[model samples]
Target chain A: MSEALVDALNPALFWEYRQVLLRGLAFNAYVFFSAATVALIVGLAAALLRVNRAWPFRWIGTLHVEVFRNAPDYIMVIWVHFVLPLLLGKLIGQRVEFSPFASAVIALGFVYSGYFAETFRAGIQSIPQGHLDAGRACGMAESTILWRIILPQVVRRMLPEAVNQFVSLFKATTIVSLIAVPDLMYQVSMVTQQEMRPLPLYTGAAVTYFAVIYVVAGSVRGLSERWRNKIYA
Target chain B: MDAIPAIRVVDLRKNFGALEVLRGVSFDVHRGSVVSMIGASGSGKSTLLRCINRLETPSAGEVFIDGEPMGGPVTANGERKERPLSDINRMRRDLGMVFQQFNLWPHMTVIGNVIEAPLRVRRMKRKAAIALAEECLARVHLSEKGTEYPARLSGGQMQRVAIARALAMQPKAMLFDEPTSSLDPELTDEVLTVMRELAADGTTMIVVTHEMAFARDASDRVLFLHNGQIEEEGPPDQVFGAPKSERCRQFLSKKLQ
Candidate 1:
């Protein structure tokens, strides 16, 4: 048991495959950034729809949020990778296939957008009606008021919640490995199979994820808090 | 031709479901004149003020600003059509409003709030807007605090910033909706002082207020609203000193106490 513990703790195997693992990690970053952008834009749209005066728009926004938020991430990834392409192919009368990376990004982006939508909506609702009234009283158009007055405050108010969602989004990127996107997890599993030693490979993968998430999330939260204080103080 | 009254309301009525908030209320605010509306809590003073700006659409009657009718053209049958949004927005620019809560945008510095309307609505040059904003800030005695955010200001200071923001628009008239009600006594005095200065400057103004002293001292004319109608209206001396209506007299005794 002592020998196995020492072997699992050794990170020599992880060090040996540094080049390939680093490349795989870079892929994870790419997917995270792309998905984060998608999530932010779509999430804001959904939130606006939910708050729209028309019932049809509100219902559509509600349906989108409920369907995506409740769906399991892994199942979503697989469905986007396989089933979605087939459905699209049938509709368009041609073969439609998404790359594993594309599927991973799309699935994760949409799922996270639901959570972001709620956060944005809460931020928007928290604004005093008096603020909107002031904007209108000054003769601002509705769109101008939204962009100038509403969105700026909403962004500040939603930062902490959005940061958490972003962290969760980054962590969720690991799920892409099952769809054969060459993320850090997929590289670790491949190295494990080749080396025929699960202990060090899996342990190394877990540690790497923990270290990256901790450092990155901690820095983002700290920086954002400082910025908020500087402005709000 | 005689100059048009700055604002004229003809039998304005507003109903929230079955509850009638303003029942055939009518009044005129002439140019450079100050009119103060005083009433009990539910007497629809705020509602009437809101209706003047079309923030609350009137269920009946019409408002004419500078002799131009609000809402839209009145058809032969006297039905008012909805005006284009752009037209309403353009008209609203002529009316500067200050609220009780001093609704300054939190994310902006004081100058930013003051300059936003001038820059956006008027489409003024940046330098011109800044110059105008500075002048307005100076008018409110907040020239030194232009860079500070609204959160850092005291209640009195924030209300002054709100006034500066409204003044930047160079509006035809100013509307005060209980502008000092949210402040403490000391802070309230500061805002009322600024208002008195504006009134003395011949700025057209319509004020809805619970401050009987302000209504009595600063107004050219005082209106006493009771149950959604103007129960009494006259010069402040006539209305406050010897009200014709018994209800107006009773209401003043409670507020003044």
Candidate 2:
């Protein structure tokens, strides 16, 4: 059985399929990075809007969090991929479509932004009221206070939670492959069907994900440690 | 007639819900004079100081700076009209306030705290703001600690940094609300010494303090607050030396003990 297993897991096969698998992994990387970046910005905007003095903005921000957070990621992604473009085309009288990658990114970005928004809001609230009073007493405008004092402290304090959110977003990238974006999971499925081999192919995919996660965890730890001293000081 | 006072509160009143913290409080601090407000805890001394700059809105009455109404208009019905944000900000620039807790921006270095308002509010050049910050820190005797963060400093050092941050704005009058109340007995003297020098240099100051010595020595006038009203006010020589009000005498006797 060992001999057969070794023979089945041939180096030649892996060498031949390396380019396709690597391309799929690269595509996964792109989707996760883009979605995570957009999620961060949208989350920040939503958090600020929720806390803003204006009634409309606060309402809109609350709606964003409520709608997206309660919905499932796969269902949202499927709608973005299939239904959104058709709706837009019918409404606008133009054939509107987003590429599979774009649809996946947008769907996942919105879904995760809701969670990030709550995390950021908690961070902002953790700051003492005295800090805001001090800023105002120094004659700083509200916008200046938010930009110079509040946001910097929030970002620093929220770094650990942000890392967790990014990791979750990275894992969620696998769901994009269901819409045929040819990410790592999609490649694994294709290779397993073509080769009639499940064990070695799935093992390879698992190892790839583990490696990426390990690197991410290490990098986040290093970055967080370096900031710990400077931020609270 | 007399020169206009730097700060005057006319029949100021404040309420937190049904609880009235200040009921019809009034006082005046002449330009370049130091007036000490001494009272037991919860006597509305801090609330009165805060209302002077509209940090806390008054439920009634008015605050005047240099004899001009400081905040927004009062309607005929007596509701306080909201002032334009820019106008409120402009008013805050001329009135510096130091808190009991020091309230230093812990994320910023000492010089950063001192220079922030000058750079952002006054829009001074960075180099010049730094120069002015250094001067303010020197005035508070914290010139060497400019690069240190607030958490790295002792409570005394942090309070002095707070004073330097206020002084850097070059405000017309400085308000000290229990500035030394959170410090050690020895540390209190350090802050009071800097304040004494500011008083000597003829800066208009309103200090809410528990330091009887500071009230007696550094202040030109002393106002004793009891139950949200001025129980006694006179030259410190009279108020502290020969107290007339029974409330004033009792409060002083307890404090001195």
**Candidate whose DockQ is highest:** 1
Clashes of 2: 0
TM-score (2 decimals) of chain A in model 2 = 0.91
lDDT of 1 by residue, A20-128 (tens): 9988889889999999998999999999999999999999999989998999989999999999999999999999999999999899999999999999999999999
- Each prediction's total of clashing residue pairs, residues at least 3 apart in sequence or on different chains, is 0, 0
Please give, for residues B1-257, the per-residue lDDT of candidate 2 as tens digits. 25788888899999999998998888888889999999899999999998888778788888888777766777899877778878888888989989998888877889999999999999999999999999999999988998887878989999999999999999999999999888988888889899999999999999999999999998999999988889999999999889999989999999998
State the weakest 10-residue window (summed lDDT) of model 1 chain B: B1-10
lDDT of 2 by residue, A69-123 (tens): 8889999999999999999999999999899999999999999999999888888
Which regions in candidate 1 have their CA more than 4 angstroms from the true location? A1-4, A230-233, B75-79
lDDT (C-alpha, whole model) for all candidates: 0.92, 0.88
Kindly report which residue stretches of model 2 are placed more than 4 angstroms away from their true locations once superposed: A8-16, A52-60, A231-233, B73-81
Q: What is the lDDT of residue B134 in candidate 1?
A: 96
Instruction: Give the docking tier of candidate 1.
Output: medium
Q: Against the true structure, whose TM-score is highest?
A: 1
TM-score of 2: 0.93
What would the TM-scores of all predictions be?
0.96, 0.93
